[model samples]
Target: MRIERLRATPVAVPYVHDEIWAFGRRRGQVSVLLEVETDEGVTGLGEAAAYPSADIVLAVLRSVEPLVLGEDPFAIERLMRRIELIGTWHHVKATSPAIAAVEMACWDIVGKVCGQPLVNLLGGRFRERVECFFYVARSDPAEVAREARRASESGFSTCYLKVGSDEPNTDIERVEALRDGAGPSARLRIDANEAWAPGTAVRMIRELARFDLELVEQPVSGRNLDELGYVRSRVEVPLLANEASWTRHEQLAVLKAGAADVLSVDNQMDGGLLNLKRSAGMCEAAGLPVVKHSLGELGVALAAAVHAIAATPNFTYANQAYGALLSDDITEGFGGGVAGYTDGHVDVPAEPGLGVTLDPDRVARYAELYRTEGAAFSFGDPDPVLRSPALPKF
Candidate 1:
């Protein structure tokens, strides 16, 4: 069936707590939800993280309408090719989330038409449930400890926290506090967001090793693979690549450099689910595991990734997710916050397509929220000084 029109809605879902990273803080996640209607009266749902900004993602959808209109929804590969080569978005990585949303919609259509779940279409289930980690909002040592305790009590085995504050000692103190609160059994993961220098990363990771961190993410800058390799070689903690591996090409470069122990992959950052599978295959060949990275997504996007992760082997670690942070979800009953998960894991829906239905009322509520106070949820710190910090804060 021919494609008809794409409906895009921008929504801002509030977070239980402000997600504070090295660069900025967001009170919630901004997702550009999409629905593609085909001439055959089939509707496919998709979601895009407002990477960079929501305005840019909206503009991309508008720009890509002409390329996507009148195409066959089943011709996903051909449709994507036109959007990439003819539309000339191959090199423009920033437009990936919008393009990915459209591609995800097409896949949803295919799944519905075939009367099979997305997991079956991609590959048979390797695992029934996909595990995720709890994201602890960065705060003072006491607060960090409390959040870690909460995560442990919630039955989450893995807890993630952002490091790389201006003062190195502050980050160390928080890590120590998280370890103390999470106790010995829980796995601790820290993301520095390219905030440390090679020397500083080595020193900081060595000190933080006392807490027995499961993984250290992007301590040094992602731009230079040598720097990542330098820090990785000196530290015993495994390095998970983020900025260094946004696309397949960059992932290949990272593999060649032998920079990271574990790689972070995202369907939104690359293109779509097919590429997500390809990324897993490429990393699997290298005998390395991949963790799904988030630009901060909600139910629709999370469900889409869950199918792929459930079907694919080698998603060895509990990937990054926003469930611990989101105050609510737009979906009906599934995939919003910690409540959507059962013991730190999300089960793939057994129904067709993405298998999660949007609660239009909640969607409208969040859409109105996006309309009125969208600025508060963006990836920018309200504090002017915190908005722009010198990278490699030693």
Candidate 2:
């Protein structure tokens, strides 16, 4: 059956507590909601978020729908390939975010068609739950330790600490305390958010190496690979690449350069499931592990990651996929589209097609928080070479 209609709605939700982290805040959940209607009368829903403007993301959704509209939703790989072909030529930065939403909806459609959960469709679950890595934002070392301890108590054996926010010494103390709080049993992972200089990254990783951190992520800047490689060579701790690797070529380059040990794939930034699988396959070939990086994803995206990870072989690591810790707004109560995390690990969702459904009443209330105020709007200029007629009628 062919896709008949597509829709995207961006929603924003306020942070209920200390929901803000180094990357952004829970100040709002700006998710791009999607609905894909098939000619056979099957409708599927999906959700994701964009760091870029909602208008731009919406435009991306609008642009890509036409290419796949009259195509078979069950022919996922072929549909993805078509979308990628169009994305490569058009310079659509939000292609992955848009594709992820659409791809998920397609998967949902397939699952409904087959009368199976997405996990069953993708393959089958290797494990009931995916291990989680708790996230501790920039804070006092003691506070960081406390949070780590709490996460450990909850069954999460891994904790991802946000560093490079302060001086090297202060960062050192926090790492030490984080390790201490995690008490050696829990793995300690640090993310710099591309906040350090190359020289400083080398120094910081070298100093923090004594704590035996599970990995130090993007210690140096993401823009400079030579510097990244240089820092990677000098650090004893495993250097995990998060923001640095994006497309296939970039991931291959990072691996060939001996820059990273772990591949942290963000489903949104790195395109959709198909691209993520491609990247994970590359990592598996290289004998490296893959983990999904969370960017404040809700139940739908999180569930997709779990299913993807379960399907892929050699994903030998836990991901920082704990969005529930950052927000209790998943009012569906941990099954019907609500993600649950304990001790930094999440039990795999058993629902068909992400199994989580948003509470319409809550969604209506929260969507009001989405503001276009101060948004630097960009009516994207279509690529000169590959412009197609707008399918959604703009």
Q: Which candidate number would show the highest lDDT if scored against the true structure?
A: 1
lDDT of 1 by residue, 299-358 (tens): 999989999999889999998999999889999878889988888999998889888899
Candidate 2, residue 169: Cα displacement in angstroms equals: 2.4
Error of 1 at 2 (Å): 0.9
User: What tens digits encode model 2's per-residue C-alpha lDDT throughout 274-374?
Assistant: 67778888988898987777666666677778777877776777776645344544336552211366544566666677666767776666555565422
Overall lDDT per candidate, in order of appearance: 0.91, 0.70
Lowest lDDT sum, 10 consecutive residues, model 1, at: 380-389
Residue runs of model 1 more than 4 Å from their true location after superposition: 384-387
TM-score of each: 0.98, 0.86
Top candidate (TM-score) = 1
